[model samples]
Target: MNRLHPLSAVTYAIQYGFLWLWVPIVLVLALGGIFDPISPAWSPIAAPLGFLAGAAYGIAYYYRFEYGITPDTFDVASGVFARRSREIPYGRIQNVDVRQGVLQRLLGLAIVSIETAGGGNTEASLNFVSESEANRLQDQIRRRTAYVKEQRRTKQRSANEGEQQGSQRPTEPDADSSDADRTGAVSGAETDTPSDPTAVPPDRADRTDPDSTPVDGEEPDAERRAYASEPDRQRRQRLFDLQARELLLYSFTSFRPAAVAAVLFVFFLATDPIIDLLVATAQPVGGPQEIGEGTATNYGILTVVSMINGIVITYLLSVAYTFATYYDFELGRTGEDFVYERGLLQRYSGSIPVEKVQSVTVTANPLQRLIGYAGLWVETAGYGPESSGGSQSAVPLAEQSRVHRFTENLTDVETPTFRSPPTMARRRYLVRYSLVAAVIVAAVFGLAQVTALEGWYFAAVVFVAVPPAAHLKYVHIGYFVGENHLVVRSGFWQRRTTVIPYYRIQTVSTRRSIFQRRLGLASLVIDTASSRTFFWGTPTIYDVDLEDAREAHTAGRKRLQSALRERARDDDLGLTVDFT
Candidate 1:
């Protein structure tokens, strides 16, 4: 090891302590098969190996760990044997997220997370830096990114002499002085050498200039200036005030449903054991009703009833958990980025650069259908197979108009006309499929025997309920292809709509199952990364609610087919997409 930082020693120590706690587990395995025998051959060999294994954890974290901010990259290098480095260009950084778990908070430390497009693997964490240092680092990164952007711009404009010029951009902070200071600084640099501003190396200038201004009217220089800006701490404080607007936007979005689902799922899983316990206790002893257990006594119907009771309790618990975690979710706009932050306990924050967004999807469930609530998701790129969520959503659910404006404002593109799915034409498919379901329900009622009122009654119930429900889901299934993007919206009870950026599409496949194939209908699956509309970021939704809906949505879908297919499709349709 070259050397360890002062804190590396503590970090290593903690790693070792945690590793040592695994001793019992290792000991158990050893005793089960090998550790017990103290043979001359085994004792000497095993002892050293075991000691080394135990010691590796601490040495490993220390040796593998690294963190630094390079001029072009903010990087974290770690991983013992595999050796991984997450280095993101200052330009690639989308945002900075900071958090402090209870332990870190107690230690007065903050963990800084750097967010980048397609750079999720890094979830790169700082061991624990002082809270103030963490903030400073974040601010510093913003500064460096701005400075670097400036350097690139200057390079672009200075062309043939770029190499010599960019190499000398100033390193000093932007001198935020009055006109007097600006003039003085320019003159001061000149006094030192008297070189023309254009002649000065861009790199040297960026390195030295705290407040560097771009030359007037040059395109490349203007672009960089557009992206980079000095930090204004005051604006950071205003972020809180914008939180409410974000929350309002998030309320109707699919994020709310997804969050609700996730929390409920966690709680449902957690409470299952308790429900099982309750059911076990509720059962009667002995008799014909009892289950086989240590007790020989039989119980009455109480066991089954208790289980039902338990299920009820578990469901309620899950609902409660949903309410708790996503109680006040927020998703809003800040400058050119969309911010998403939520959670009552385990809070999470994320952002999307307006340019990185690929598409959006909207959906709804039966409940949402009644309430005029819907969910929306946005898709972007740089996320692939290993991504945590396949579907990247923006606002999971929102009122229709709000969702439109959200998409419109975020993209700075016109909201293409919204087309509700064909209610009757598509209803044909749902009705046909639901007919099968109605038959099944009728069969069940037939076996139960009352077959008179119950017969017509059950069949009528099925015939009426199934198609209506299915139609609701189908009729709402529609998609829209806009200037630069595409959207697919569907769902009756639990409605969902997804918007995907054409730029981010990886693949689009049209599939047909045996049933659908027989029906001459097919479902189109658009594969993408974590999308705001995707449930848990999963890119696929099942069973086409509309046979022709896919056809109607083909323009955007074809964009993802193949290089040739995309070109041909766009050519045929004459789509003029502006790539930023």
Candidate 2:
């Protein structure tokens, strides 16, 4: 078995030692000065002792850990006090991801993660390995996985052929047959079945049968021949590379609600100090009454300035985060997998198998829409550390036209014209918004009665804006049912359009809220295997007429069944991967 690079011990030591460093600081704070006098004097030595213990553990782990690739499996063995061994078959391996942090990059090392299907975590991790070795391992695993799949296919085909031949064979001997004819038939059957089960037949020696059992002294070149036959070992085609200008624009346009909340929290915390500072700095130009009015004016101005500053700070922080997370993002495709490499501080490289893709989404916020920019996300079956709820950002920001084209190409379906919900849906939204506005205005009116609040009527502006907001919401919501895909679009602030292939649709149902039912409407929801749907809600066509909703649900189910049958036919012909 192969061992990790020698420098890995340093990385391990740093990680383990940092945990111990906190121990001494906590010990000193907790017991040194309050509980024990001698603890204070000797506490200084605890740091070095902790470091030594961490280093010892790191060295021990390094000696124990070992990993290697066998003919059909990736094996790992590692334990400090207890021994553990694991073997993962190449056929079951879903992804081989490589990541490099600042420290690891400086050390010329990288971390490799092995992920499998069903589990939403890495199955095996190689903490620190040489950069070149990491690449080699990824390539080796890919090749082996393809080889294993091909072998299984070959065996399945052979088994099927054997079954057909057995079913067609005569169960009873033909009494009318001549002795010579019976003898010839017996010889042919004996020839097909080898006397020594492990020996290859002379007639079929040149052809490699993947299902055949290996002979005692089989040549090693047979495995090499199998590897050479796999078609997946090819050059990758570049699909998308994020531009600096696009990244900058994306950062500005990206609206994170959490960032706004964080800014509000900080602003409220600093508001009192800022007001006090402003009041102290103000000069008294006249009598006490005039000075009081001037101070009040200064307080209002200060509050406005502080709010502006908070907004600016929030924007800057959001931009900085976007830069750090998505810098140097690049996407490529190799055979049936889409490969992506991204991040500035901690670089990540991984592949998304095409067969695992559940749906494609195109999103554009108001700002992005105004600038003609949009983002594309691909939802897959399992989850990854870098993915947001099973959705991977394929293109963070790009031209709307380009994003649409890419989506069409990936899913092999044309974008269809969307059908809007009935006019009653718009009326329902208007009524809903008006009711909410009325409640806010009533609340402000009550508050004004107890306090010296002026212009409580300003809160009535929400009623004035209700009509346009409701209309915008209705306009943005629509659904499309195409020949092979179902598309749903909704949201006014961030317009999201999701394209789900029919075969990938896991469920189709209709739901009606009290308000929707009152309006004689229901929502049609389409669910996929993506975990995101569970958390964020399924893609839905909201406030459709009850009859239309039922019709759509039935159509979606029929389409899903038809698409599955087509996919199965294609799989039988070896045209697509059978993820199942």
Candidate 3:
């Protein structure tokens, strides 16, 4: 078993040190003036003891951990107290990702994470390995996975051929047969022979085509060698590269609501401490006295300024984060894999296997739509680096037409002509928005009566905007049933158009809420093996007529079944055999 680089010990020491440091501090605080009256005195020694404990644990862990790559699997053994060992088969590996942070880059170290289908997390992680070792491991695992899959296919094909030949063999003639039976059988065989003079014999048919026939002593994989000899530029197609201007636009448009929430949370947590510090610093040298109205006014002004500052800081941080994560993003396709490299601080390089891709999504927020820009995402099984809902951004920012073209090429489907939901659905949305507006207005009116709230009538503006908002929602909600894929589009704020191929679909369901039922509408939900769809919500044709929803569900199920059957038939006949 190979050990990680020696520098890994320092990384482990830092992690374990922090953890151990917390343990003693917490224990000292909890036990003070309780079980031991002198426990408070132990706080002074806690720091030194914590450091010693952390160092010992870190060293032990480094000594216990071991990992190695085998012919069939990647083996890992770890644990200081309890031994644990795992072997991940090469055939089951979905992705081998390599990442390097700022410190790792300075130290020439990297982290390798291996993911498998349905794992929902990295199956095995090798942390703090040398950069060169990380690259070797990734390439070796990829080659091994391909070799294993090819071997399995070859074995299955050979077994199938043997079974077919055995079934085709004629049964021996009965010993009781008369002489006339033997003579007839011989004549029948002679008649079965081809009579056309130009017909090629069965045994020599393959030899007729030079490309199909191998030269004497030639290798079986000569074609693969020729392919490998091709230039790198010809081997991979560049799909999209994030430009500086586009990246800036994407940073602004990709604002997350969570950032606002985080800012508010931090404000609340720090408000009391900040006020206390200010009060202490502002107190007169003579003595403390009641804060006057002027002082209170100054405090309020400061509070407002702080809030504004927090908002601005949060926005800047969000932009900085986007830049750091996608500074030099590039996406390309090599054979059956989509290779991507990104990151400004911590670089990442990985590939998404084409076979694992479940769907393609084109998304554009209202701002992006106004600017005619959109983003593309490819959803696949399992987890990936920098992925949201198991989706990796293929094109973070691009023109709408470019995004559409890329989506079409990836999915092998044309831009679908979407069918709008029935008019009843629009009426339903209008009623829903009107009710929401009424509720807000009523709440504002009640508050105005109980408190000195100014501009209470401003709440009425919601009612004025309700109609247009409802209309936009209705216009954006649509679905298309293409020949090979189901496309669903929805959301007014961040419109997303998802293309799910029938072959990747796992289940079809119809849901009808009480309101939907009252409106005589239902939703058709299409599920896939992709974890993204499960966590983020399935692709659904929402608020359609009940009959239409049922028809869509049935059609989706039928197409899924037919596609699966065709795939199985191809596999059985070896028509979809993969040599790489």
Candidate 4:
């Protein structure tokens, strides 16, 4: 068992005191005038008292929390009032994340966040540990997990081999059998031939062991065996990396400029009353100018200044966020694991188990697509949709060619050929967007009627832009059913291609809404172990021909079944009896 760095207490105390400081403000607001007489004076002393209490709690926390790493499990003992102990097996660990902020780095400490296949929350977090110790513990757990899996596989093989040998051995007749039983049913002289011990049972010779049954319509053999050779960790290869300049370029390609501009505009609008108050109070050296009513020049100057300020602020903020999030991004590979390190202020280092990766997605915004670059994401099981933020970027940005090359090596499969949906999908998209435009127009008309702003009717022009938007969407939406995986490509602005292996699929569904049915079309939705695309994310191919949807569903379901059968076969190999 190990305790956290002593400095962790300081970290805890600061956090606790900062949180406690909020109590005084809340109390003052909630009590209103009840304690008005003493509140002002006591407010000055509240923070120090809170700090003392926080220090006591921090010390108590230090004593209560303890962690231990055994051969197969990582144990954490915690809880102040009621003791709670948790033990996570090494094999369940999905990723081990090491994080070090500037302060932690200066103090030679790190935070180890262990994520498992269970879900979003970190299974166990060891805060404020020596950086070297964190790395060593992560490595130790990895080695132990691999050893345990290998041991299980070896036992499975031995059991299988024993069954094979037992099945092949000829059964011997009972040694103490009567002379009549010892004699062959056919001829007594032939049965007397040396009293063979390896004689096949006359009745049971035809029976075969159910445990040694064939899989995939074939018997197990060496050629059919799936043998994976572990890689040499000493030679971890650099698979991909993003330079500062490239990262900056990727940031510029973000599709939020309009949204940011709108937000800044709204923010300025909200602060107008405060700005007016400040302007009225401030006495200027030069007297106020005599501005006439409906003067465009004066308002234009103010607007221009505000726009410039907003642009500068938004640009600076965007740059800061980009650099902090993805500075010095690098991806490395060792055996069946991927190592990623990035971030400027709080550096993040983590390892991803390749086997746990459910799918790989290649995405490109319009600007990136024009420049022939795209971003890559790896989705793992139990990672919910874009909302839950479970997916991780494999690479922030790379040329399309490089992305495909890396993806091929990662999945051991070629880039799947994509097929566009039926041409009629163009009409469906046009109808969908046009309907949305009509709704907006109707709302604008109603608002104009209420506000008497008849000019709002011009907003109906929004419909004019819908046709091209619909066309672009139709052009981009496509799907591909590969030999062992399904690929869905969609989105005109941020083009994304999601590749899902059949083994990861949990279900296949084809749905037809009222509009789709009227158009003789249906959507094919493939659900996987990861819920990453279940909601707002594009998880289905929409407006495809009904027949096409059915075909895709059938093909996907068949492939899923085949993959499941393969997994079942593997599980059978691991079903050996264990003797401690």
- Point to the candidate with the largest lDDT: 2
Q: How many residue pairs clash in each candidate?
A: 89, 0, 0, 2
Would you estimate the TM-scores of all the predictions? Answer: 0.60, 0.77, 0.79, 0.75
Clashing pairs in 2: none
Between the candidate structures 1 and 2, which one is better when assessed by TM-score?
2
What tens digits encode model 1's per-residue C-alpha lDDT throughout 1-580?
1223446547666666556655645555566475445333444445445545645666677767777655567767877768887777877775666565556656666667776666444456666666555654565565565555445544443443344457787676566668787888766643453232222243533442323433454453353344344322323312222234334433433223344455457557888775455545664432242244433223334545655664555555555554444445555543344555555544444455544555555555555555565555555555422145434445545565665565555454455565553344355566676778777776776755752223345455555666566765566666555665666666554555565556456666777667665555556666654433243344443455454546644665555554334433332211111111
lDDT against the true structure, per candidate, is 0.52, 0.75, 0.75, 0.68
- Each prediction's RMSD over C-alphas, in Å, is 11.7, 7.9, 10.1, 13.2
The superposed Cα distance between candidate 1 and the true structure at residue 173, in angstroms, equals 42
Candidate topping TM-score: 3
- Evaluated at residue 377, the lDDT of candidate 3 is 79
lDDT of 1: 0.52
- Candidates sorted on lDDT, descending: 2, 3, 4, 1
Stretches of candidate 1 off by over 4 Å are 1-15, 21-64, 77-87, 91-95, 142-233, 236-277, 280-335, 362-376, 383-387, 390-400, 412-464, 501-580
TM-score of 4: 0.75
